[model samples]
Target chain A: MNEYKRISPSKRFLINIVLVIIFIVVGTLLTGGDSLSRASRALILQIGIYVILAVSLNIATGYLGQLPLGHAGFMAVGAYSAALFWKATLNMPTPVSIVLGLIIAGLIAAVFGIIIGIPALRLKGDYLAIITLGFGEIIRIAIINLSGITGGTPGLLNVPKYSSFLVVFLCVAATIAAIHFIMHSRHGRAILSIRENEIAADSCGVNLTYYKVLAFAMSAFFAGIAGALYAGFQGSLFPKSFDFMASINILVMVVLGGMGSMLGSVIAATVLTALPLVLQALAAYRMVIYSILLIIVMIFKPSGLLGRYDFSLPGLIEKWMNRKNKPGKEVANE
Target chain B: MVFLQQLINGLQLGSIYALIALGYSMVYGIILLLNFAHGDIIMVGGYIVLLIIAAGISPAVAIAACIIGCIVLACVIEKVAYTPLRSAPRISLLITAIGVSFFLENVAQLLWGADPRVFPATRIIPATSYQIGRLTISLTTIVTLVVAIAAMVVLMLLVQKSKMGKAMRAVSEDMGAAQLMGINLNRIITFTFAVGACLAAIGAILYCCKYPQVKPTTGYILGIKAFVAAVLGGIGSIPGAVLGGIAIGLAEVAVNALGYSTWTDAVVFVILIIVLLVKPTGFMGASMNEKV
Candidate 1:
């Protein structure tokens, strides 16, 4: 671990950049070709979207240590906003429209995050959960009732399918990087401190409300981006798609991935997103499996699968080098 | 006359909500944990009623079986899922409760299929109506109101006058202190869950008679709404639950009457948000002090 820390900041940055580039290149090569089936491509894209969703939720639930049950509400807001923006800018260049739509989606969701967070965050624990849930349901209801723009329950159609592999890959990488940077910064530490003990954090001069709202809005922002990607992938929007169950599904990913571990979130999201598809033969038992897994995991391993353990290439290499040096000594695993 | 009829309708619905809300209130009072599976317990009770009725059992026996089944399921869930997590963080307990709820719903779907079964309400509660001065009241409505009220009254007496009730109140007030005073914490907790389950089962029967259908997911919305009612009425307060339930029932009816039936769900949440904002403790909730 000491040897792992000896790697300077510049070297760490270089390593991260290389890893991301390798990931992007490999993803593009795998999905860019016509060799893979359409279903597989779609599945890969979906994994990317869910990865973003889980990580974004981790910002508030994992890092901030607050449970907001209305993540799907923010996603719904983003999905509809991006869908509307893209629908209106049909004549613009596709790339420009998609980029603008994503921004608008995220910003709109962030604005809502601020609006809801101010009141909702004042309460703690289960009250916060229920209040967020109420807000989420309200957002869906609003979308349904405002049929002139939202297209009501039947759904808004003709959304441009822009969530190709490259786009989704970049978005996923960007979300992870942004969250990673934010969590390492002073503000991120403040958020973590608050999660550990709110009163102590407050006494230490950390602004509780500001940081809480900030983490919440940032989480909402990324959730919005993921929602936009989802809208483009599906080419339609329905209020039903972003209901309480949808929120729970995203939450299940965050929980199943150890809370506060980005790598865990990514892996859990990937596995969960694919689990249903892989178990298509037992579709009826899929949710049953998920619920059972949730219960058993909570009971047996409440900290989750990884339990705050994150993966780092440099750390792995450091361990490998140490093992080589000590021959018989086993390097401890986290 | 229309207003009077709607008032009666509101009362019937409100009584059902009140019963469910009572369950939520009592459990929350005892453990400070929201039993998310409380509603699903009602769903299980609905299934039990359906099964028993199908087996050529008398309505009385079927109802008894449903109540007993709910009580047993609630106790089993407490022992299996929640007991181990007694020392875990509140969030973990909440998550486990959600897990238990989802498990119940999905398992029910796996066992009974997702399709809703028609509840034989007429066989259970006689289908009849009475009219007086242009006002009509269904026999089901009157029976639901009377039975719900009777149950509440019985529950009130039990809690206020019984030795077990005193122990329950003491435990809820301070668990460690009550245990030191020789109260059996485990027994009281299980007994609280059983009581809540009993109320939920009665609510389920009343709900099926009114709606005439039973589905796995039926409890989800009802549970949430009842939870909202519990919160609105000030959690841990019995009268508050009753008041909150009635208010919600009336608000829902009023929204539907205004010809915006689709918005009724949204309106209930709106009320919750507004109540939470204006009075975070709720209309009846005592302000809780955070311990260092």
Candidate 2:
């Protein structure tokens, strides 16, 4: 236990390996078995998807200090690319097909990310926000009209559902760990500096252009991973799935979770994703309540519940034990 | 003849873009807030107009009611969403505005369901068509173009000739100094929002008349395009919004004519990115120097 300071950066690899093992083991247990184990597995995969989305988006929106409303566009790119690749590799081994899909989606999304990131990075505030939004709409509209390649109004379906909870969880956990490593490293700090004060970062010899592109590419890369997994999980996704509205929903989840805190993003993702199922009785007013809650939360804790705070077991123990049986969402609901 | 028709159509729709961009430019000029809710407010206007039409109200009355409703909604948004975040940083307020935009759209869907409903079909302008020199124009197009131009001219006068206009210009130039000069910040913002919303109401009515179908989410995309136009024209500059909107409108038409309607957003952004890359101040905008 006298290893806190003695553990050099090279030894940090061990800590990462341990974290990966924990991520995989917990996911397998949650998704194990057959029959009634269905609901938990679905829930686990959904959480995995949210984690990937929040972490990747945390780069552009939270880390880089840019607000991009059209991330779902990249998700669409990955989803369609992976779905096509998966269909082509139907006869290949499951692992081969999954790897191929991930590669295809990630590569395509990264290319598009650079194209978008380069030009839009010139401006800040509302300018970046609207430009990204326009890009999203452009991609969606192109997909819709290019029915020949993209299947038009009817998106590709019957994708190989190879996205087991373990697979999804590993990708997400890897994304978070990778992002965390980057954030703590020299490059990551440079990105954070850009977020905090671009001028200062520029003055401090940080190549703003390179770091900005690096951040956006990283964000797109993980977003593509999430999209690839989504294609395999959903079995089918319409072009409408990647519309502006869905992008906003993901943005809301990330924002509500508290930006920059991977822990906040995880909790917000879990709570928001599960709330609907928990309050099925009040389903009719789901959005109204959600909106009201958002307003109230913004008015009070504008930074969110765990604003830039991590989700440690001790924090959960303190809140859960002190509070009543929670407002909604439990195993019974599932 | 085909080119002429498309050009006219572009002008008509571009005016709508111009109408909406006024709000973006004004708010950015004055408070430096992008007011992302500007688009959702347009959606609100469309929905209110739809309800009024559903009640069998006359088109004229509905348009009047719609304008009033939009004004109220805009003012409410300014007070609830923007005013409280006044002391916060620009980005915080922008995030709040985005949150509000999402809230309004989701709330609209929750209340009315997700279905895109049909607005009451009534021609606000006569559906007459006239042909001259191998060019054909409909009453709706003609009226929309004329009315849009008229509105712009009036806005120009308001900004250039009036005392309030001077205050607004002063504020846009420097809020801190404007406050020292004893101008009412809150009133000017409310008025700016009201003016923008009222303009959107007119555009909404005409949009319904032309398209004849209204959806709960109609305003979101249109709002973004208008904001793009504002940026292109050089935000905070009034003439810039008008010119930018017209350029966007013409570009959309030209793109469609060139067999690239699918790439309309992409094309619009390409042009915008090009402009920003070349001159970030926009067509009519001068670089703003913030006294940090």
Candidate 3:
């Protein structure tokens, strides 16, 4: 029997460590060496931020099976909170301030997420979407109106640039790992069960409110970290940057990437973030083309590019070894 | 006198919102989809009016072209983008609608640039005012209210008293049953979109006359607000849309009058959150029980 065997935990850990090392090496090469243009490096960093955003959103839209249109709202909360923190603690060591800023950003965004999620998740489907959207708008308006602190329409300027390639790499890795572990645990299965059938899940004795809010808060938490990275990257923050369109852009990435697939989110985020930059000559047509593509993708493949399939190097290696050992007894596991 | 003037202003604005919200309500009632592109269709109508007027066409012809343009666009979007995904997950359809929305907004931006165009009010509606008692109402506001009310009344009559409307109701009630009953699902859906688009075009024209500007991104916020109205009114209910619209418009005006003009948008959203939290089904919406 040539069935694909699961990789051992220790081997999987080794594979992950190797992959992370490779990522760090590449990141260092891009940031340290002047081989690529500054713009290209910045683009890569932006892709990393979007990867965090997309994967975090997947927790809600994919695993939880609820569409919250105001992801950027949470991102905005994280960004503004982190920016304010960094701005205030500029006198501290850069690394210390940056770490604290990210934590504060994540925690504050999680708080807002709980606050929004509790009331918002009481409804389902489109009603939930509209409510979250309203909350998003409210947050943005609050930021604008509280200009004394948020800098109003002029935006918060001159933030410390602490989002180097290393920082972003570490954050992206942590986010993916955290999400991967949570999604693999019993809690993840419960979240998935809700997505599949909320009523069935509730009948199975899953605490619907607790898990829904939990997934939402976790999603908001990572989005907050990404926002903190973004604030540090841009060295400024604006309420307008976290508007509805920005949320939609991130959603598009998650949707295009197969929902519930971290690998898909990473790849889609990378490609989409770089596409506009690469096609600078067709900049005017970029969004139009992107939208058309989105429509086409939805129409043809509603499950998205990956359809919940995740990539695993160890799994691939195991399958290859199995194929070599048994030529005629091949069996598909998935 | 100030309160009276503000009331008139609120009514005018609310009527425009009600008109737009009707389009949202009608389309959403028939299809469980949000049609996020609905607002962009109104933006397209605004561009059509601007272009036709710029081409030196008569104002009446320009307005006609605008309405037709919007109807055609909405119908085409339904056919091209949404028809195939009728059986897909609701989220997919919603995302596709967002795609269409971005597509329209980007196309408008590409064709017309990102700058706002000054809609010539005098060229269409006469720039006259009526001094009634202590309230001075502009002719534009009167025309907007009259046209909005007239369109809404006709829409209500059509939906309530017509055979096609019955077909639409049947389809919305149960698509599979409606098909079994020999209703042409595609035709009814397309017709609903057309009717909704026509109203949106009318609302767009009135909105332009009232605001005196048109831009690509204008529809995004306007659409969200109208969607809020639709939600606040009971999404599938027609009269609920109007009541929700008027409530939002009045609340906005009241905030502005309270010298918190900058917080108008915030106030509108606050009302929406409160309404949704307190009444998820909205004011006039019938609660839909989920079947296992």
Q: For this target, which candidate reaches the highest lDDT against the unseen true structure?
A: 1
Query: What does fnat come to for each candidate?
Result: 0.69, 0.43, 0.80
Q: What tier of docking accuracy does candidate 2 attain?
A: medium
Tens-digit per-residue lDDT, B159-213, candidate 1 = 8789998888888888899999999999999999999999999999999999999
The digit string of per-residue lDDT tens for model 2 on A1-334 reads 1111234455456666776788688657656756435766777787788778877887887788788878999999888899888888888998978887898898899888998889888888778887788778888888888888788788776888989877787787678778888998999999999988989999999999899989888888888888999988899878899987778778777777877888888777888778777778987766656665665566666666677787544344446554544435333344
Worst 10 residues of 3 chain B by lDDT: B283-292
Tens digit of lDDT per residue, candidate 2, span B36-90? 7788887777778778767777777877888999899889988987787788756
Q: List the residue pairs that clash in candidate 3.
A: none
Q: State the lDDT of candidate 1 residue by residue for A242-333, as single tens digits.
A: 99889999999999998899999999999999988897898888777778788788888888899889888777766775654453433443
- By summed lDDT, the worst window of 10 consecutive residues in model 2 chain A runs over A1-10
In angstroms, give how far residue A30 of model 1 lies from its true place.
Answer: 1.8
Which residue runs does candidate 1 get wrong by more than 4 Å?
A: A1-5, A321-334, B287-292
DockQ of candidate 1 compared with the true complex: 0.74
Report, for every candidate in turn, its global Cα lDDT versus the true structure. 0.90, 0.80, 0.89
Model 1 vs. true fold: TM: 0.96
**Judged by lDDT against the true structure, how good is candidate 1?**
0.90
Q: What tens-digit string does per-residue lDDT give for candidate 3 at B16-40?
A: 8888888888778788889899899
The parts of candidate 2 lying over 4 Å away from their true place are A1-23, A290-292, A311-334, B121-123, B287-292
